[model samples]
Target: MTTAPGSTRNETAAIGDGLRGNAEELLRELAGPAARLRDDQWVAIEALVVDKRRALVVQRTGWGKSAVYFIAAKLLRARGRGPTVIVSPLLALMRNQVAAARRAGVVAATINSGNVTEWDEIHRQVASGAVDVLLVSPERLNNPDFRDQVLPRLAADAGLVVIDEAHCVSDWGHDFRPDYRRIRTLIADLGTDVPVLATTATANDRVVTDVAGQIGTDTLVLRGSLDRESLHLSVVRFDDAVERTTWLSGHLDELPGSGIVYTLTVAGAHDLADVLTSHGHRVAAYTGQTDPAEREMLETALLDNEVKALIATSALGMGFDKPDLGFVVHVGAPSSPISYYQQVGRAGRATERAEVVLLPGPEDTRIWSYFASVAFPREHVVRSVLEALDYERPQSTAALEPLVELNRSRLDMVLKVLDVDGAVRRVRGGWLATGQPWTYDADRYERLDAARTAEQQAMLDYQQTTGCRMEFLRRQLDDPALIGAAPGSGACGRCDSCTGIHRDTTVDTEAVAATRARLDRPGFDLAARKQWPTGMAKLGISLSGKITEGAETGRVLGRLNSLGWGRRLRPVLDGPDAPVPDEVVQACIPVLREWDWTVRPTAVLALESPDHPVLTTSLAERLADIGRLRNLGTLYLRPDHPPVSAVNSAHRVAALYDSWEVPDLSRTDGPILLVDTLTDSGWTFTVAAWTLRRAGAPAVLPFALATPT
Candidate 1:
């Protein structure tokens, strides 16, 4: 074992070779016969097993962070210490970590949503001292049953605790997750003697400090170099989505072995994967929406090089191991450099060289702003959530949704923040108020939001910078070592700026035409809402159960978030005073041709749009003119009943309940096409169609220029 710098010879001798041999043996099992532990890895393992000290490791990806914990768990178990408890963030990560543990001869078991049937057996194994490591999702920490029953026991007896992706524990981290905040309490509950380790690949200096403070006092933070010698970085600027998609389709094959192609949105991932597959590239789309079983298959396919790429969102990132991944191409820039680095880090891990390219698009900023808009809800929203809580009874998030204006995801995030503040607690059934006084940390949230905005700006700057791209990224993370390096000295000499090797920045005119044709092929399925949202009667809407008569599955020109016609359709739908544009009206013809409806609409009906009446009416009139159907005019909005923004089905249904009146039900016969400027939450369409159906329309066909997904 390598002694600490300045350790006395006698002290080094006393530590002996047996401990070193064990660690070396564990490393051999993990990384092969020639493997040896880095000095930092050995130090971290010794700190956990021998010294029983808390350690925070902030190393780059594929730097053997998992090896430290796995080896430490093995050594601790040999000495009769209880199983190491790991707070992992994702199922992909847990699966990989568990596999890594087994290779090291450590019996690791996981308890996550994927295997509820196996959780009992896993818990029993941990209790029986048969497991060396226990991997769990951070959200599991807040599970009612787990928190109320199992957590205390685990906390008291755990030999060592490892918080993987520890950057998440800090709200300032790029990908701040609410459930990760629960780890602070978990660590505080552990016995004093139990050692703790927190590891992350993407933390900046600020994140490191915040995470270390949460993990406890005198915490040892080991941050290594962020530079990736294997990465050949470049930024390719594109004027539009078609050009970018076309470029990817044209040049994807030029990139070395199988890797990842990241898209900012799930739709973008699927769309790009489709476009590439059409161009004969072997690729698959992976996203948060992917089924667990399918995700496993995709991961395995990438691992075995069965496919060239997994066109994915950030869901496929962090803890997915592919040693020979040859490239990472971003269809659009991520919101921040830190996040970008985390995704790109997945590539060039085990290889000496890998290509990293960024195709920055005109819509990138819009996407970034859209995400930023959801950051930290207003004070009123937070207070309203707290007000809706009952001290005597627990309320599920869905139950709380109707009582508060915040959407489900935003509400769940706020609830978690409240949980960490001790204002509420998760118990059996759902969440209940603790009746504790809570102060809204307005300043902190503002600062974090501002920090995010700043990060976005930093990414933009990174794109525009002419200097070393890698150095710029390193500096953005506030890597002190890189910051202190002489100006221009840290230049990687591998990026486009340094090497002057541009990889066909311009897409061929033919390729661009093909891509434009693909994008212009505007149509997306708009499935009818099957059932009314729960608890609608309480909101004074009698709607419940399955819909007896409603719109058949419909068609839209495109999603409001789609990279194709959405870019054109958004302004027309969202802008003021103007009529629906000629291009959008013309685009609808093809959608109409391709739409396979059960029954053809014989008449047209427009839903009243107080904000965009001209746009909505013009679209309906134009479509009626082209389709040779009777224009039956719009549903009339009740006086003084302006449009209300209801983010969920229950609230949306209540807002529009009895608000629309068909002027003449006698005239509303046969299938009528329902037209609207846009559909969000799909509640507007559902309610409008239901109203029309009740007014004696045989069937309704819903059409909108845009539907927000």
Candidate 2:
């Protein structure tokens, strides 16, 4: 057999023989001396260090994927090869990798969004060969400075390239990040002799194939059994949010040890965390909105077992490593079984008999639909974006928002995808069109959407399946070991279905009442939009700078996605137009009474809600009567102009620029209460309030039945 391109027969033999001993020593340093490298781990390391070939390792979460790379880095570095470059997905993962590298006597430094100040020093260390491993987020790959100035040298010099959570590289992956596509370009720039490795615990057959094809057709695939004996899986159905929270509050302490409680929404996390805290459990909320410093502190707290669990969103899913984590309870099921498997895999990694429970809610599909809406835009939207961009000039996202129908986050996602596809370039100022011909790839996107839908159905099936939970997940992932198992021997005999044992589904009456009361307590501040979105002038709107006359801080009865009022409000908002429900009207009374406004409103006004005219009108009239305030007539929209669509702020404001015909409020005194059925984007309230204030109202106090979360 011929040796790899960069190695002679003698060198290959030395790598095979002497390298194993060194790798074992490094593993002992990384893990304790009692630890040993599994055969598959050593196989991957040999493929990388000995054969200098690309490899993809699909192992379970606790299988020490990190060890294979760290030991390989050390072995390669010992041979005077350059430092390894790791494309990590999260800051939490980077921190763990860096600390683990130190245990192995490898110098590892990370440069990510959280450490902008340390980047220069880290770069200097990498350049001086003082760092054995450098971890960077996938987003850093496309950073203009990094892509233009730093990546070429790093790619040329990297001894080994590792993509952790490599399933994300594929659109077929549940968490398909566009930035991971940039890795293909980086790999293309690498020398033929440089070895590459990609690893993930959650890839299905499609995702694995897609990632392997992207990495290289000749890549070595080391796939192991996707089974964890320590996890006992179960699904508990809940009648409502109150029951779910009550059950958690009643049963949290009974869990094996500190672990995670996941919610689908940030608001839900905070809400559940609050409920659990009130029940005398120590918990903290973690989400994308969590500050980096606070996130680090919370992560440390969890690792130290100071907190019972972290109530979190998907932001906590990918890289959090807690070896003895006792449980993972999902308040709502994720959109797919692949995502569910990855999340539940977090528990029982190092401990025996960890609980993995799913409390499926009726509202889960609604939340899933909301997330699905943010996917790749329609072909028309993409073409519109391309047409609006300038070929030579860089335009910020803010500048382009008014010209497009997409929201900031969705537009940013589109731009990133476009940049990765060579249709646009993200430069110093912002984005520049490359004038490159680009196709919409409708077939690929349709397939992805279909796969997502199928996965969602599979998740629902998993929840309702009577067979072994682990076996079902394995089948979904197409685990290779299933083929070798004896017929009728696939069951682990640990899951609720297999063992015929399930957690208690009953919630105490008092606990349920308390949870209901807590959730029913409504009112979240609807912060006023203070600054005008940039580029309004381009839309023929003269608005700019601070809004001298705008709505004061507003009050929302509750979010449309809130645990308690959400259940009441979703139907009212989503259904056909009708008078405001008595329940919602009653809910608003407490909100107004509890609002800490500086001055009481003397008059009430309603914005024209074409979809819910009766509801908005009835709400305004009822509030005026209840509060004993003047009933200012409705603000009618121009006949030709429709209600502003829920696009970005700039477009919304422009649509509402001259659309509302404010009623005469010159005779009104104190604050004018502006009532609308729903508040999304908050531009309607701002523009309407600005119109009211300009029309001689002293102040505008915006109140809404609900706001979309």
Candidate 3:
């Protein structure tokens, strides 16, 4: 870090005094970046080198996580021990760390494939015991020769092992690199009785725990709250792409400074760049393929203010530092909030107020009947990967590829993929990446991402939740580190909430939304819905109740008779001859109402006496559930039904309410509950809420449980 004549020495001494003259002096003596370390950073380094505890220094992107390891290495070296080995993921980051180490007079060398001729230097540094830290990718850890020779020697003197961006160990991380599993094995084999330091800017509880478990770190947790007070968050709704583009064009010159526009896909980056360029905004696109020159151009342009914004995927921010990113925009939904955060974090680097806009399309959903067939490989992949791991030996991608029945080539391809994009290198002969690529059933491997689609769908659902975006993200990350004030609450005055420009007046749009909220409260009806099992139960068991072609009259009557529910709706689940208890059937009723049936109108719209003692408290919940119900494909009462995609289907479904028995008016006065499941029909919520209010309910509180969407 730059300093006046002796500011480096002064800062070093001050930091040493703060750390009681532990590792701080060594770290400061070797500091090289022009960007001086902040006080908190020194504390973090002290925590690492002084306490000698495995540390995780969680910070926003570009906050200099690499420096922590570099500083730690010097102290380790000063102890007359060997240099620490940093198992880094990104090549650019590795290159940068190596250079920074050399500049600071620390013996640092990397063994990436980019420099095959440097092996002599690498071997010399290793044998000479002159290096302070040997930077290697996870793949390098698997090399038998290196592990047997170079690593063993280093391990004898090793004092610390650092795993950067440790979240890849968790499936919840943005890019789950499978090669990460081998890291623990590598650490164990290295004989480095050193504290393990794992660090990442964005990780939830699950990721942190998973990393700790994988890396064998102690129980100490390093957590940073997810609140970036400097960043503003907003969501814009659009049903038309053209309209979205037009709206985005209007904001092309936001904040009049450097910023980033992150897209879900590479094509999106190019297209958005083109669009912004057309709108007279100085923009450049940076995807995985952006050359070093182009990357340099983008980085320099941003720092020089030559370009107002960088239209790119999430890859543009690594290895570069620009303190003043004015804003960030998302043209499409991010793969996950983790992806969203890392990309959005590019802006507001200067700790200045910044803006982030998330645009979503509101659509009416009509189930195509095929959604049920969607494939999910969560259980299968987890099972396969675990089984495939050679728990005793290294988990070689090559050896494990053929054992799986799925597409071997694609399986191997996906299995060897590393996290955070290019963090894991392919060792020259390591079974994981350098071995012969497997060949097998191409179909299975071809659709690996397809298998993860279910997870993505679940992610999409969370993104659309209307609770609190911060809470949902926290849950997904499962990292308790993110539990604090709700994000985007406008407390910072920079967020969209504070600005009021993106305030969702549409949340409680229905006239009786408050009534809907009341109906959502717990009561007998509400409890009944809770008892219902998901549709995955066995065939007949999965059926909630029978639906009689165009009507459910006899079915309800029979069930009620069977359980004596009709005898008296007074909480009767005690039938003597009933195979299922009266309470069982009673509890199953609300859930049964939700089951899809073969009858034209598979579900019967039935309501209980809301004012009744048993029903009074549960009234709002039942009504809210009903309001959230999807139109399900409409049943055709008329002999001649319109095509599946016709207006008549919508009309007939909307009119079904006219034929319900025992309509629970009080239930109609509740917030909609079931709407969360219907991604395709967020707008149907409005229509249903409007219909319910007209039917007489207290109020309709149609909140989607705020999410990152």
Candidate 4:
């Protein structure tokens, strides 16, 4: 739970030609920021400057997460601190750090995106000790060309390396970058003595340990509560977007800080920004397609409070900070709950009360469908890409695309698909492919597929839940419990989930009339679940034993089979022929029926699906009832974040779990409680459950704790 703040993790330096003898004093004299270091910062500051070994300090955002880099640079500039290089996943973040360092009167420059003449000058300054930190994106450092151009030419192999957004290194991280995996080799190429400092805000234990391994550095993961207590989490569910937008406009006037309106698509972001602007809200529109300067200007305006709100896509946040942000409202469901958590986290950075809101629409399905279509590669395409690689040195997604006669967009989709499937990984963009991509075992794929399915179920649950959306998310993450419930609020309030906002079950009688009006969808607006205003109930079971939780694969085939009910299980197995055994099903049938009533139909339907291979004995073994809770990052390859697994486990163990909660867990009262437990494998899932408890709900909470490693 404790890790060194991003600071000194290395201790070797060769002074600028003539200054070796007095480097320490000279470096200290040059480093001066006497006022900002309050008593609170002293602990982190001293921990970093006092030694050149490992240490971790978790301070809130705006408290100077960047200052740690400056201090480290000063130490490195001193005789003993280490020659340094910082690899960040976010270019903006790196720029911010470099800017901060230079502002502190410390010389700093970057070797990314732009040309070499500048890099060479910066390199000279670094070697001469005029510049203390050389900031680069993993793209530049991992580039064989970039490395060849710079590494040997530097003063010495950088003795200190800091990876900002360290979570990217973990395959399980929310923001996984293939290039990050190659960092281990870069570190190896740098020599073993170099101590690496890794920093990130969203990582859990799994991410923390994975990062340590990836960087080959003793980890310093400084963790705090996943819950941003100052932030009040809420969601708005509406019959349609018209209702959503109109309601949002009204809420915007009441919220103190300017709000962030998140849309699922770039076009949606543009339209919403325009609409809000027309309504007299000086709104800034942001998305990936935006020009850098424009994005900068708009973001600056928003941060400066010059505007009342900003309407953008999810691309607006990550690796950037806006502490004054008061609220974030999603217009629709994101592809995954993890995406939701990140967007919501952007708000409430200020010390005052903040709110996170969600407004889901039926069109969310279209959004998800689009994401799935583009984000993941088709199976045949994957086969083809791997086949194409059979002869060539691994190529870029573009090169492989034409050979397979696919378009760039299609090719990119396939690549992303394979990445999540872990079937093929372009770890260093183009340089690092899984050495044996074809060797990916069927069992592993099935296991991962099952994990994804469970995650999807959790998302659906949050979308459809009728209670507090925030609380539902937390409970699924298995946070400790909040108990002692009081009574429920009777008013519908402004949220979409209130029964007042929607109609009860309908008959087919209105189909013709609804069709005449070109009404949204013919069937139930399943996504309507996000509107429930009150909190949630908590209950889920975690399967134990037969698998080492913290290991590379935390699967329990035996239990999975037992639950499948005496039938052939087609788990996404690794290797050529890891099919489900017949004998395993016989043992599972009796257990399946006795397990939970809702479990049978879903399990059967899942078995009939094309992706049934994901259902192994332990794959869907965990099951729990939907408690007032929320969850995410549960199914990733991260072992540090346990709440995600419990949700997945709950899906496997639950009597019934559905995507039907509305205004999930906003009200209802009880002592906040979360279920903290682990799988037989020693990986932990924490946080989300507790966040759910805080939102509201009174029910049994459970998490399958990992056995101690």
Candidate 5:
């Protein structure tokens, strides 16, 4: 091994001792008083700092995985090594890492979508060797400017490369992010002398195998026990949505400390947070739709224990660090056991006897099916994306969207898959075909899909398991220590099944009534579509610019995914064709009475619904009778038009361009009410409103019972 310049043999031995001292000092500074490095942590750090070899640490969360890299970076910098590069997955993770680095007296900076204006200064810091560590998201690896201009230099010069949440790089991992796959190429390009470290808390054996194989040759694998001593795991299954809502409302305050409440959908997150807020809890909703600034603020609020909880979706999962988080309660079960374990692992990290509960809902499977549809694109979609590319001219994703039916995200994923297969390349302008042979691995994708289905089934099984909850989870990860826990005695002795100590199942009658009342109350605005989607002309729809005359802002009882009334509304909207339900009719009365329309609808005009004709006609007739208005004959659909949601906005507008006609109106000059079953893209309502206005109606008020997210 080569030593640093200007160092003799005794000086080198002294320097080694100094390095150990430095690591110990930094560990205490980072982990606080009485902090000592675990043997496994020292092993991984030595392999990186002394051996200069690749390592994979698959320990549970709060296992001091960050400490290994931070201390290694500090020691390496002292030896004149270049700055360490950490490829993390979430902005929350990056934020935590930067703060942790600062406490250890290490200079750190980040380049992500949130800090575009500071990129130049950050780059200058990197150039000057003033930054000890640089954190970036995986997606930033594929940016045109970063990929072409900056990545090469970083790859060759970085002293250490860390892939945090490394399980995502494998296809078999629970949270398989396509952007993380780009790291394979980055790994292959790095200098052999540059030490690499990949750390994850949630990988099973299969995922660990795949990630280790991809990271490098002869990688050191460090696997630790998955047991979390502080967590008391339990499951509480409810017969229906109301019971679940009542349970959460009745027992939220009783949970030990400030933590996270996770939901399956954004609408669910918002609805649950709203219910909790009305019941006088300090809470906020966090999801993918939340603004970047607000997400940062919410994260801080949770860390400081300023709020009791933050109702959120999976967006808040992975790499959020709060050591003292008291509990983690799931409103709906995630589709996979690994995912569930990851979320629950966030709690009980630094506390004794923290509660982890799963309030499994009856709708979890249906929600799983909804997300499963986007798991992987069909073979035809992939082929179309490849076919659309030309070898000589690069075409941007937006330009290719007009030729292919896939959405932007799905297309981007297909392009990435092709890029990895060497069938396509991303150039200066966009993507171009490489004219290389590529085979779609039908069997591989099938296995992946089947694996996902099995994971979903495993999650369901977990809820019904009679064995130790923590033991079952560890076994799912193929933990080798399970054999030592005694056969048939793997129970943790802390779960509800083992201890007979469970949450109170009783619900307060008033709380249930209040929750029901809030759900039953109806009112959500259907903001009129003000502008046409761009590129409509290419789809044979000439209408462009803003629509000055269209449907007025309207109302729906609630979103289909909303906790309030959603359970009752879903069946009515999804059920067989029949007259509107009497209960739904009763629900709409309040919405009608509370509507503050500029012009009262004097006549009714029902939009044609081949699927729900009876519902629309009955709704229109009932509303006209109650409001004392005339029932104008309904508009008819042109033959051969597909359902509004069957395609994208451009195609939806094209199919409905000249598809509706008002057969006869008793009062053509008066404002009219247009009823439909549901609204998704709102283009259907837009075209219908334009048709009615052109047919001489003064105004149109659109109404629906539900709008899908």
Candidate 6:
């Protein structure tokens, strides 16, 4: 046996003997008395406890990966080691783990964004040796104060380091997160005697190799079959949104028990939740936009069967432990088979049978392309960000937005990447350049993009595959059990393809009509931007603070990504300039009529669209004629100043600062209706309204054919 550094062979053997003797009893304590460790589980526990080496376990979701870690942690603590530090990925996962630890008679505490007020106390408990396991989100690993002060102490004394959902540590994984890269530093800081465990259920061969290498060269890997016997997988295709909704509305209750209905976009979740509720199904929309507290409540609600399902996006994917979850329905397929496997794995973890259905939409590819656009920025963009940062003084994200072309979310992602690369450091106020020379890995990014495209193709293949659905997924994940299986012998005997038990695609005609009517109904409120983005003056604009005279709450016919009116308006907004469509005109009339405006507009004004001039002008004229309002001249784009192409808010506002030449509106009596083809960022309307209000118009009411959600 190999002895740990600075330990004699006698000591190592003594520790190994103690671990071997006590492991099963600890497992019984953690799991129920009747529950016993599987041979692989014991192998993993012995590796961490006796061998004192890093191990990577790639098993199915409900395969008692948590039991192995919790039992190992209890044994390690009993053997005079410090507490275990688990770098968990999600708040939901952390909550579940903490509860599981408590049930095992192990004391556990979590430090996350949702529990800021408890952090100091938790830190105190850890320092006082009162906490056995500390669960922290990967993002917390890079917090400046925690990194400089708390992490070093924890790393120095931690007995076992666990990375839950460890696939996230690999860029090749479906959900790659830059924050997870910080785990490399944490692992480096620990003593060689301290053991490490990285657990994930959805890693392919490439991801497993990548993550194993990152953990250590001597890491042990325990991989098993990726199939879930309880899952009965199938795909249901629909030609249009109305047909999909009709089928879902008619058949949602027939699916086993309360479960999740996944959507590709946030707007789709909200829209589908509304549709489901209207059909008398108890449901709520949960997305990245959901508040943390509300998310906790909704999770509990789902656990208690308070609602039929939480119409959710990928936000609710990992580490949610509802063992009895009966079904998982995807309204649109994710971009990769690995992602699909992870999502559908949430069902049937502790149940006998669960239904997994994918209602693949034609719009799924378009949504995937939209998400793919936010991949790593070009080399010049990274260089621009680095050059804009001050080496001594920190610059907040808002302060840098004016100097860079990336939006808030993309900018944050870039900054985090740079921070991980040691090119920048996030301090108390914001980010500071570390004077570290950094090379933009163009080849690496290109390779990643290529891999993503391949994964997308694999997802498409999964939807169309005729062979065993479970076997196809297992092969996609490079499951070892399928290596030598006879041809056509790996079928699960459960999926629709295997059993010839496809769901009836027939949706009721009346349900279809009602869904179509609901989808066609237009209009959503466009809340005005009340505060100007900071750092505007640095971009040569003097604006800051509240915009008292900005446009009032506006009306949108539909969102471009919305289920309703989005399909109809995309052509008008994205296609070449032409006469406005009559159906679009009819849609606008109802929006205007339903709008509970304090005072109706007496004049119509159109914002000049260089790309869609004919469409904008025709719509303005038609509305003016119909409303019997004066036709105010258009707000023309100033000469030599083309429309703003900047993506971030501050630069967008700066480009629009003096770009518009508003016609005289001093003679306009009532509120003047402002027209635009689409609204993104809401900056155009705010700036134009400021110009018009300064030019003596009464109140400005912004209207648009569509806006992005």
Which model scores highest in lDDT? 6
Give the Cα lDDT of each candidate.
0.86, 0.90, 0.51, 0.49, 0.86, 0.91
Better of 2 and 5 by TM-score: 2
**Model 1, residue 467: displacement in angstroms?**
1.1
Instruction: Name the regions of candidate 3 deviating beyond 4 angstroms.
Output: 1-47, 62-64, 95-107, 113-120, 143-149, 291-304, 317-320, 361-409, 414-492, 503-709
Higher-lDDT candidate among 3 and 5? 5
C-alpha lDDT of candidate 4 relative to the true structure: 0.49
lDDT string, candidate 2, 1-709, tens digits? 2386788898877758787888899999988989988999988999898778899999989999999999999999988899999999999999988999999999999999999999998888888999999998999998889889889989989999999999999989989899999999999999988999999999988888999988887989999999899999999999788898899889899999999999999889988998899889999999999999999999999999999999999999887888999999999999999889999889988887899989989989989999998899999999889989998889999999989998899999999899889999988899999999999999999998999899899999999998899999998898999976663377889999998998888878988998999999988788999999999889899999999999999999987777888888888888999888888888889899988899999999888887889999999999999999999879899888865665888888988888877777668878989999888889889998888777788999999988787
- TM-scores of the candidates in the order shown: 0.97, 0.98, 0.54, 0.57, 0.95, 0.97
TM-score of 1: 0.97
Per-residue lDDT tens digits for candidate 1, residues 1-709, read 3344577757765663577789999999999999888988887887777668899998888889999999888888888888899999888899988888889888889999888899888878877888888998988999988886778888988989999988888988988898999998889999888999999989898899999999989898888888889999999988878888888888888899999999989888988888888889999999999999899999999999999999999999888888799999999999889999999999998999999999988888888888888877888988988998999898888788878887788888889989988999988878899999999888998898889889989999998988999988888877756766787888889999888887777779998887777766788788888987777777877888898876788888887666677678777766676877788888899898898987788899898887888888889999999998889899878887866777755677788878876757576557898898877677777888888888788888999888765
Candidate 3 per-residue lDDT, tens place, 584-694, comes to 334334544543433322112222221222321232234334444422221122333222221121222333322232234453333222212111222223334334445
Q: Mind giving the per-residue lDDT tens digits that candidate 5 earns over 1-709? A: 3354687768756766676777889999999979988888877887788778899999999999999999999988887899999999999999999999999998999999789999989988888888899998898888777887778878977989999999899899999888888888888889888899999988988999999999887899999888888989999988777778888888889998899999999989988888889889999999999998899999999999999999999999899999999999999999998988888989988898789999998888989998888766878878888887999999888667656776667778888778877898887899999999988899999999999999999999999987888988888887766756674466788998788777778888887888888766787788889977566666767777888878889888788888777887888878898899888888899898889998788888788887888989999999899898888857888666555443555656677888875666544667888888888778788889988888787899989888875
On TM-score, the stronger of 2 and 3 is: 2
Clashing pairs in 6: none
Model 4 Cα lDDT, one tens digit per residue, 1-709:
1233463333222222122233233334434423334443333434344434443333334444555656655655564544577787655565566666666566667876644568767766776766667787776654555556666554255756777766677655667776566566566665444555666655544556667666545645454334455666555566645445656655677777787888877756755665565556677778878876677787778778988887887767665667678877788777566556666767776656676676777666655654554433345656766666532255665445435534455555455545444455553345234545444355644654555456566777877777755545444333222222321222223334533354222323343233222211111100101111111122322323242211111112221111111012223222233333444434333333342221122110011112223332122232212222223212222233222222122222222222112234444333222222222312222122222333343421222211211
Top candidate when judged by TM-score against the true structure: 2
Model 6 vs. true fold: TM: 0.97
Q: Residue 698's C-alpha lDDT in candidate 6?
A: 82
- The candidate, 3 or 4, that scores higher on lDDT is 3
The whole-model C-alpha lDDT of candidate 2 against the native structure comes to 0.90
lDDT measured at residue 546 in model 4 versus the true structure, 0 to 100: 40
Error of 2 at 349 (Å): 1.4
Query: After best superposition, candidate 6 residue 323: deviation in angstroms?
Result: 0.3
**TM-score: the better of candidates 4 and 5:** 5
Error of 4 at 587 (Å): 61
